[model samples]
Target: MTATTPTPTPTPTSPSAPHHQPLLRPMDLAGLRLPNRVVMAPLTRARAARDGLVPTPMHADYYGRRASAGLIITEATWVSRQAIGFADVPGIYSAEQVTAWRRVTDTVHALGGRIVMQLWHTGAASHPDHLGGRVPAGPSPVNPRTRSFTTTGFQETVTPRAMTPAEIAATVADYRAAAHNARQAGFDGVEIAALGTFLIAQFLNPRLNHRTDAYGGDRTRRRRLLLEIVDAVAEPWDGRCVGVRLGPYLAAGDLFRPDAATLADHDELVTALNDHPVAYLHLRGPDRPTPDARPDTAALARYRHRFHGPLNANNGFDRETANAAIEAGTADAVSFATHFIANPDLVTRFALSRDLATGDPTTYYGGGARGYVDHPVSTWQDNPGQQP
Candidate 1:
């Protein structure tokens, strides 16, 4: 069925009542049973072992602390060395990387939490600094004019070499191998990172993908890479255990502007996903909407009728709005990024209606234990009569 297929009725709760939060309800995401609908959105902390691109012991501690989340999507992980865009981010292609991620999954599973690894390829968003001075590969030779987070710091993006048919085939293999590694690492599932201007997204965008090959032409050809990756990933794990993230309205840094054609392409893409056994469609809302604006919610609703599977709304979601989205049936679940960073026990905090701790921006990326795992949990004293 497509993402627009009607889902089972969610638990009935008053959206206005804080004690009756709908986000705390259980959900059956494809085949994975989630305790609550509050999913922890993936956040890149850049804390992996720089040399081997392996996850560290700190990753276990970090993810383990946020085990209360119904589902935790680990930070964007490189599928291969060619997928490298940001410095210090973990990769799943190596044996050591798989072993390291196993520790993280074990920690989260031990705490009774479900977790998924987000597979990523930065494409033109990458810098030569991260790729051993070699230019990155993309759908076309177009330069996104974006910046990449390098070891030295942020570096300007350079024009990427257009991927050949053989190279594209190899990249697809890389994603399949990565999914297999994630399974070996004991993750509950894997999320294909197609959001923003990432590699898969770069191929999906007509503007960035200027190729005259079969992978270019119409919207169907443009989305061929993403579909191929999905089919390949299913070889390692069932589509029921796989999720796809898409950013139809991602206009960050003026890179991926959502024009009529682009938006229509996304609509077709979402509809086409129904043919696959995808567990859920994770849709990112508009970029940087105003605090009071429910544009994210509106954006999700716009596509709610297009997709038939379970829909996970992301970007700038909070406790109340999340509950409202669930109540309104615009989203099956909501994923939180920043709120989850500072409040590891975010599920519990929402249960108790406790104030959340703000994360330290300075130590957000490429940091030690400070901003990574040092966020404190709320005490029982902070919420009297609330059992957490």
Candidate 2:
């Protein structure tokens, strides 16, 4: 593969334009040069081939359209068959999947975009129907009490069987293999999807993890699994291409919401993670959907102090607020989740103060190009292939 640079369209600004709009400036994330701070957060758009769990042309078109983002983190991809949780979610365990993902990277890079593949293991969040009638694997045998949106409809999360010592080793090996596969697929970097009460998060939280083994017990022990997986990926990438994502206090609809006690553990874990020489740390700040649900300013400040790396902030941030975050030095970059879905030209729209398009929630999850790649771009289609 050839090397490419992410270049944004030059926008002319008036004399009143604020220099503090750090969201529009170019920055270096690890080793990749990002054209802007507007990151496309890893969204789970389940539209891949169900049988092979591979990306399709639709996936390429969807991501290619959003190439204007500084960094495009693809949907959480399964590392192995045991990590399978949802229908139509892509994977990296097979050669065919790798080949298909290379197409996505090729298209994105051809359009001068940087893309990263998020490695994920759903753990107990997976239902048996999606896992070939097999029980899902977890750190311990506890039910998260959540449900998964499968093709068969909403199914209650099952009590996953605790992985044995050998199985734990195998899972770590799976992560290493996935990292290698991602590199072969032409990913700029890899992000570990450790949030949302997945395998790694399940091990971190005491409510879900009830094991008395070495991989359990104390906070350090509970966090050992994640550290081990990170180290596994680090061996190949040398820690430069791996980034870990954590949701300190996220409570989205039907997603894993950490309780008060777990929040304390999350704080300690962030400090512990500082020891690792990984890439940027992505944090999903407080999701304030209602008026009463406000962002925890004090906790966010403490977290910024504790972590000593480039921080990427997420969770319902508009253009103005995201700019404030960068200007205040609270975060290095701001990531947008749903906003990118509606506005493929989100960065351009923000720069020109244009009206953003509203995306169809019905077509957000399982759909074709109707809602994914059909989002209109005003005048930012430089590449012919970027057209939907």
Largest TM-score belongs to which candidate? Answer: 1
Candidate 2, 1-388: lDDT as tens digits: 9999965544443211433368888999979999889999999889998778889999999999999899998899999998987778899999999999999999999999999989999888899998778888788888887888789877988888988999999999999999999999999989998888678888987777888998888887899999889889877777787889988686533335667767777778888877886788888887676744544445566678878888888886787767777877888998898889988888777766666788889998887878888888866444333311
The C-alpha lDDT values of all candidates are 0.88, 0.83
Task: Write out the backbone clash pairs for model 2.
Answer: none
- Candidate 2 lDDT at 136 equals 87
Clashes of 1: 8
Per-residue lDDT of 202-246 in model 1, one digit per residue for the tens?
999888898888899889999989999998998888656889999
| RMSD of each predicted structure | 7.3, 7.7
Candidate 2, which segments miss by more than 4 Å at Cα? 1-20, 252-260, 289-297, 379-388
Cα-based lDDT at residue 272, candidate 2: 81
lDDT value, residue 302 of candidate 2: 62
Q: Choose the strongest candidate by lDDT.
A: 1
- TM-score of candidate 1 on Cα atoms, chains taken together: 0.94
